[model samples]
Target: MTISVERAFGLLRIVCEADRPPRFSDIVGISGLPKSTVNRLLATLGDQGLVRFDVEDKCYRPGFGLLSLAAGTWAGLDIRRAAADEMAAMLAELGETVHLAVLDGDEIIYLDKLESAQSIRLFSAVGKRGPVYCTGIGKAILAELDEAQREAIIAGLAPRPYTAHTLTSPETLRAELEAIHRRGCAYDMEEHEEGIRCVAVAIRNFRGEPIAGLSVTSTASRLAGTRMTDEIRPRILAAGRRISAALGHLPTPC
Candidate 1:
């Protein structure tokens, strides 16, 4: 079953990445699979609307089902371009690494990052996934979510100690999240990576739901003492508000 599934995806890749729509022969040749297996898998893919047989061109092309999937994915997240300027400005002001990430299931996925000019900076990259219960970006986002959703996420978490400072107990993490909610920001005090610290705030959509998180990260020495609260926290919180507003979120009247 696994081999069959792999072969199916193998054929699907050949069709999807071709310069033009690929014919049956093209897929078989590119995939190096038997003709019978290719034909059977193509039929299965066509049935699922992942690929289609183009009558006029007599070639395989990506199907409307894939477009439907893509649309659903793209509809929820479109904040990168809107966030670029704010990230750049934050990086310039702090001379620290800036990251934009979104919650994906039980993890946080980095979407964009602005490199710090300083010789010392946190090690991270766009597309990297990190534990939701530990990182500043993840905790900030969790703090902003509705209680039911937040509880559900917390209940499902399997946390471990990444560093001595890491909060491994669910009860302790719950308390930390509550504090983040009150402060409107979250902090990672060398919890995930030793010698690294960061401040993060939630980026919301028009519905006022946290769709992403924005964070400024630097070495512990750089962010030590009152710097995180007096400097980094306020700036990142302001940037989050601007980016959320750009995405059409309106803050509730206080």
Candidate 2:
């Protein structure tokens, strides 16, 4: 296992340094590995899309897998770093948990979570993924998607009622999305977890499409009064706007 890993990285480095895609014979010569061993390693890499084999030219180069992996890592860091101060401010002002998440297919994956000081706070973690139909962040992002795209995603989801407040009906969820669009925000009224509620706004991209969502979660009783609208709504929207601007949201010319 160790030998294979070392050889694979060895081949990867060799390919990376080449002026152009290196031929099979060139790799074998440079790596000092047997031709058969080099071929096996290259084949394994090709299957994983870690290396692109140019059959026509009979050469090897780095593949989309590497690019995709690197891009995702950098993008996650960019969002987390950019939103650090804003999330901290929210945490301080409300003394509640704040979350940063991005849409991953039909789910919203929490990338960064800042827990509140209180003992009874929202239950979640950095790697946690949840249903788009029930969570505030997920619904916020889902609201901004195009009709066809939204419908496609909804067709795949089988909404389960996590609580009585959970929007289970497809028709009902569609209506909720419409309201969210008009209001430019979404709410979790104890939908995913009883006693917890959230208010969130979409973080749009340069093309004015939702790329992520930001939210604050607190106990339902605390958010029930004027706090939800007078306080949380504007604060979250302001942060969402800042994040959207950072993401290069240039409004389209009419």
Candidate 3:
């Protein structure tokens, strides 16, 4: 491996991990990079617009260039169209909301949503987004990532609590993702919204990476206990499998 390249990326990661703009001293301490090297790389990064230095706080934050790059990547995905038929079927059969989402940095962006026929139903806007450590679709995508990739994303997440049940600690969220991977599923136990609960499964690409996830959402009163296991979980998995197959993905043999 290229040592200098790795160190430069490590410094960048340190800045990204900070909840707010990071000072030079903080980057040096967290990255364990020599002060001189860190200073040089930061200057180069600033010139390239990968980071911007704030004069008032004497700290660095992610720059607009990074956001533009990320936007380009998210724009190219065809997740909404790919899962359209399956989502409609699930919504009709279960009479519950069906959601399709894909990871975007440390969050999951809702590509599409099929609302339930019931009067009491969850309604997530098509372009809505949620924390990767909290929502069912978010955790489903996170669970399918490689350990190194997932850890890198987790390092930058703030883990703020949206509800009483949110996993606000890194260790707990890490454990949760690991369990979801083993079980081939994830659950949102009112982690994002107080009245909502969901069951989700990852949607893999041809390469077997979870490019997206699908969820069946309902009121906590409807899905909070055995009803989820007895009803929602199986249907959600079946829908996810069909979508994955359409995307040219086949699960590997255990």
Which candidate leads in TM-score?
1
Worst 10 residues of 2 by lDDT: 70-79
lDDT score for candidate 3 against the true structure = 0.85
Query: Candidate 2 residues 128-201, lDDT tens each?
Result: 99999999999999999999989999999988999989999999999999999999899999999999999998
In lDDT terms, which candidate is top?
Answer: 1
Q: Distance (Å) between predicted and true CA of 146, model 3?
A: 0.4
Clashes of 3: 0
Model 1: colliding residue pairs: none
The Cα RMSD of model 2 versus the native structure comes to 9.9
Tens-digit per-residue lDDT, 130-232, candidate 1: 9999999999999889989999999998898999999989899999999999999999999999999999999998789998999999899999999999998
What tens-digit string does per-residue lDDT give for candidate 3 at 33-91?
A: 78999999988777878788999999999877788876776455466777888888888
- My TM-score estimates for the predictions, one after another, are 0.70, 0.69, 0.67
lDDT for model 1, please: 0.91
List residue ranges in candidate 2 displaced over 4 A. 1-77, 252-254
After the best TM-score superposition of candidate 1, give how far the Cα of residue 13 lies from its true spot, in angstroms: 47
Cα lDDT, all candidates: 0.91, 0.90, 0.85
- From the highest lDDT down, the ranking of the candidates is 1, 2, 3
Off by over 4 Å in 3: 1-77, 121-123
Every model's Cα RMSD, please?
Answer: 13.9, 9.9, 14.4
